[model samples]
Target: MNDQLLSARDLKVSFDLPGGRQAQAVAGVNLDIAPGEIVALAGESGCGKSTLARTMLALEDATDGSITFGGKSLPKSTKKLRAFRKQVQLVLQDPTGALNPRHTVYDAVAEGLRIHGIEGSNEYDQVISALSQAGLRPPEQYLNRYPYELSGGQRQRVVIAGALALDPQLIIADEPVASLDASVRGEILALFQRLRDDFGLGALVVTHDLGLAWNIADRIAVMYLGRIVEQGPVEQVLLDPQHPYTRALVSVLPDSPVGDPQVLTGEAPDASQIPSGCRFHPRCPLVASGKAAEAGIEEKCRTQDLAVLDADPRNWQSACHYSAQFGRDEVRGTAEPVADSLG
Candidate 1:
């Protein structure tokens, strides 16, 4: 019996373009989430991280590959799908847009119960319990208040309360704190950590912010151009990135000590017309600056395609053709990798 809470194998999601070309939103991804774990899916806007999240939630059908929840394939029937949904919930990026201005706090939280036909005389109690769990103390005081009556953080908590009302096991939160103030972002992230500790909830937090991942996630998967380029323990992948793209991302961190910040030129390539070789080669700083050639893999990087990642999700892995050369310590002329060298 596989004990993983959720697992995706060779997952691929694509959409048709006007010229009959396909835009590969998610191309051959393998990921797994254990019970009570938090995995941050970090990437830029067009890397397809959001599409992958939607596919995991079953909102978007995968063009290929398999996703299993609690050891079972995604439900096929509408009834079964609805039942499946009760176990997993989604938290959108914007709280104001997610909530109905007309609905009171109590009604918003109770909506899920009403939809699932789980409502009864205890519905009010359930709503209160969810609100309390979401950090709205003395939940009754806010029951009748409308969304416009709350602050940004409070509104987000209301959205969270709505999900908690269903007693879900896993949460797929896309940019959960992107729109909040910096002070409030910590509050929300801490709330997520507390929920995991108190209820054994598993979550996949989707964001482009590596700093956010550092704060709340146990593991990090760095995606680029529709595929995960590097993934490992949050500390390892962030502090000692192995792929050129990952290195560039980590370098730009406000406090990163990896030499000078490296800003890659140009935007991410369109998914519809992916590059021939390593999808990131076109904008890869190493390739464009001839460092890859110094190491003698530039031609291979441009002409030969690298295979999709296939290592254990918990292990340190990178999909780049020459990952060993980009480790921060190696680049800085140290004999040991970053973790050991830094220590």
Candidate 2:
């Protein structure tokens, strides 16, 4: 059997806009997670990071492409899909919204087991074990608590425990730490790492925080305007990014010292109005000229979209006109250096 736990190929997700236009939230994205790997998907809001996570969980329909778990294509029938869900689970950004206000922490965590008909004398034991794994100590103390009674971090842990109750092989965590306090976020991240180590759970963590990605992810996939601009081993992509967008992202990270102020300017482009050549040309510092320039090398970036090109044999890939030209020097900015603050 293949060791890959999950594989997504050219996954595309689009939504109908106000008019007749359709916004492509995820466009031809590809990714794979080994049995226990933690792959971080990083990008700003509206970059389709969340949409990608939902698509992977089968929460959203795909416009095209395929997703596979444990060497099997995702089920097409509703019943099969429902059965497939038992093997995959999701943890959202806001745990309060995920848990029912009417349900106690124990009920919330046990819901999956009930639905899967996994009841017995050990059901409560399983629930407690999952809670303990999530660091919700004194599981009995949290058993009767409702969503409102728990702190944000505790509630998030409850949500994670619910996912764990299913004993899923893969977990899609969309901004799992986005709502927690800084102090608690590390504990949660450590919990995820421990879960992976102990239970061999594969996780796809979607977040906008590069620091979080740097701290917990084994690999990093940088997305921009609905496409993966760069991806590779965490150290390779974080310390020596090859794509201009990836370089810019690493430079703006609070832990890294800023190199050039120009790299921080501009924002991601609108999906409907993507630049002619490259979706990120408007914000690309290596384009040779500003957005106003209609001629020269800048025009290439504006008119020519690039494909993901292999940068190394370790599965490192990037999509940029001059990905090979990027290096660590770009992140060594002379601007106001920010302290290594965890967000």
Candidate 3:
């Protein structure tokens, strides 16, 4: 049994602007999330993290590629789509805005149940059960409260409770903790981790915070200009960082004490005018520099496209030609070839 709760293969999403030009928001992304696993999609503001998340949720249409849920391709029939939706849920970035001000907590959580034709005492029990699962104990007390009455964390919990009411198999969260206060962020993240523990639910969180990925995710996928540059186990991607862009993002982390830091320059290239060859080569130090200290591989980087490969099932891989030299910048007073020192 492939046990993959959700998967995307070579997915691309594009938007056509008024000028008849198209912008590819997500470009050739391949990802999968298994039950009880957390995959963090980390990137800058316009790196298409949210776009990819939406495409995975089937909220946004993909211009190219396919999405599969529970080992089957997307359902085209209305009955099948509705059944699929029941198994997959989306948790938006803002909880306060997601909830209705006029509706009580019970009403908000029961909306999904009612939509599926669940009503009467059965609906009430499901609502209370979901609230309790979300850590809102004494669920009856919160049943009548409005969105305004609850704190930010509590409001977010309510949003999660709504999703839980329907017993979804997967939850795709776009910047799930971005809107909450510092104190509340940890609590909400813990809730997500607990969800996996309790029901073996799969979760995919999109965020720009590397630390958050380190704190909660089992795997980390680094994105740049809509393409995934590197992805691997949390320890491998965060500590070893096989790609240059991944290194730049990890270098600035508060606990990263070793390694040389290369500050990124300029803004991410526009999607419509994405540079030729390796999309990240223009700003990558190694791409322009020689293979050795005095030798550069500018020609190779400018004309060739690097494809991601499976290095080992345990360690994640990158789509860079220079994957062999990732940590060499911080050589620690060492020579390129250890045998060279003997000469």
TM-scores vs. true structure, each candidate: 0.95, 0.89, 0.91
* Prediction 1 TM-score vs. true: 0.95
- For all candidates, the clash counts are 0, 7, 4
Between prediction 1 and prediction 2, the one with superior TM-score is 1
Candidate with better TM-score, 1 vs 3: 1
Query: How would you encode candidate 3's per-residue C-alpha lDDT over 46-125 as one tens digit per residue?
Result: 99999999888777899998899887889878778778888888999999999999999999999999887767778989
Report the CA-based lDDT of candidate 1 relative to the real structure.
Answer: 0.88
Residue 126 lDDT in candidate 3: 96
RMSD (Å) per prediction: 2.4, 3.5, 5.2
RMSD of 2: 3.5
Give the per-residue lDDT digits (tens) of candidate 1, residues 130-214.
9999999999999999999999999999999999999999999999999999989999999999999999999999999988898
The C-alpha stretches of model 1 lying farther than 4 A from their native spots are 324-343
Residue 2, model 2: Cα distance from true site in angstroms: 4.0
Q: Please give the ranking of all candidate structures by TM-score, highest first, separated by commas.
A: 1, 3, 2
* Tens digits of lDDT, candidate 2, 1-343: 2667777787888888887888888877878788888999998888998888888878899999888888799888988987788888888899889999999999999999998889788899999999998889989999999999999999999999999988888888999998889999998999999999999888999999888998899998999988888898887677666677776777766555435423546667667665677787767766544422432355566677676433232677777655433333432333443444323
Deviation in Å, model 1, residue 268 alpha carbon: 0.5
